[model samples]
Target: MIRGEAYVPEEANDVWLSVIGKSLAYLCLKQAEQADPDRMSGVLAKVKFLMGLGLSQDDAAAAAGSTAQSVRVMKIRKRSSSGKKKKKRRTS
Candidate 1:
């Protein structure tokens, strides 16, 4: 069970929603200001795009933090799920 903030879609024409999203993005930017302020603008842009895409909360958060695991990571566990230990297959 993953836990994080919730993403709620606002009306397409909701002025306040747009404002608030932008505001929150701005706050995130400010929090990360020392790292690279210019990049914050890009973050803001991506956030807007994700919101437009209707991504779920977890997806958006991962995108925002750049913490989304790569496809390889997601599939790695499956590769080892066969349960045949490599050492057992080797004979001296």
Candidate 2:
């Protein structure tokens, strides 16, 4: 399960938040279906956008409202998932 923080904006307006939040949530859900952290760039971008707007990481994640840990885990996973290919040396 994903774990992270979330925050709702105050002056962002209620109606606008609802609409955008739902959209982000939908995108996150779709990414989950794919089960690929690499594919979560969109969600991560949104989270970054929120953070850029002065929202804390936790609050920005919460605002996105779907995949929380992606903001955090996506980094780790992306790095760890890449590895050099190995070739077998046939034993004589």
lDDT, candidate 1, at 74: 37
Q: Give one digit per residue, the lDDT tens place, for model 1 in 1-92.
A: 25886655566548777566656654554566656666545543445445555654445545566533542343355457867555556678
Question: What C-alpha lDDT do the candidate models reach, one value each?
Answer: 0.54, 0.63
Q: How many clashing pairs per prediction, in order?
A: 0, 3
Predicted structure 1: lDDT: 0.54
lDDT of 2 by residue, 1-92 (tens): 24675565676678787667656655655565478556445756657666665566776677666456666897567556777445789999
User: Per-prediction TM-score, please?
Assistant: 0.26, 0.38
Model 2 TM-score (2 dp) = 0.38
Candidate 2, superposed: residue stretches over 4 Å from native: 1-41, 79-92
- The 10-residue segment with the lowest total lDDT in model 2: 1-10
